[model samples]
Target: EPEVTQTPSHQVTQMGQEVILRCVPISNHLYFYWYRQILGQKVEFLVSFYNNEISEKSEIFDDQFSVERPDGSNFTLKIRSTKLEDSAMYFCASSRDRVDSGNTIYFGEGSWLTVV
Candidate 1:
């Protein structure tokens, strides 16, 4: 089965530096989303994109963050300036079903970000 994949399962960066996390979502799926979990916290939604534009976004998706579908299979999330508080497990998910059903969303193992 096709599955979502993320690179560099863990990332370490200095505060204020820019970082880009990469993902390869499941092929043939239409909806994509980014979510983060700060160590012990509940997973929080960052953004969702479809049809090449953002469909939904949470407050955490501030100016410092942006996402792109650089190619047919790759999706990327860029953080303009990393902060210590930004450290977390970033997950990439995709679903063929609509958001209302919430069944198709499949999450990657996660890319752990650490800022110091």
Candidate 2:
């Protein structure tokens, strides 16, 4: 089965620094997303992309966060300025279609980000 893959399994950064997390979603999937889970909290949706544009986003996905599909296979999330509260496990996910359509979402192992 196809799966999402993420890079830099873990990263440590200073507050106010910028960091880019990379991902390769299932090749056949058309919808992509980014989610984050702070330690001890539930997973939160950050943003969703389809047809090369953002379909939806949460308030947490403010100006500091951006997503891009620079090439056909690579999707990336850039944090312009990291904050201590930004520390969390960032998950890259994808689905053949929207969840409402009954398609399942697949997630990567996640990139753990730590801000100091």
Runs of candidate 1 with Cα error greater than 4 angstroms are: none
Maximum-TM-score candidate? 2
lDDT of 1 by residue, 1-116 (tens): 78999987999999999999999999988999999999999999999999998999999999999999989999999998899999999999998866666566889889999999
Q: Which stretches of candidate 2 lie over 4 Å from their true place?
A: none
Per-model TM-score, in order, reads 0.96, 0.97
lDDT of 2 by residue, 1-116 (tens): 77899998999999999999999999999999999999999999999999999999999999999999999999999998899999999999999999775899999999999999
Clash count, candidate 2: 0
Q: Quick one: RMSD of model 1? A: 1.1
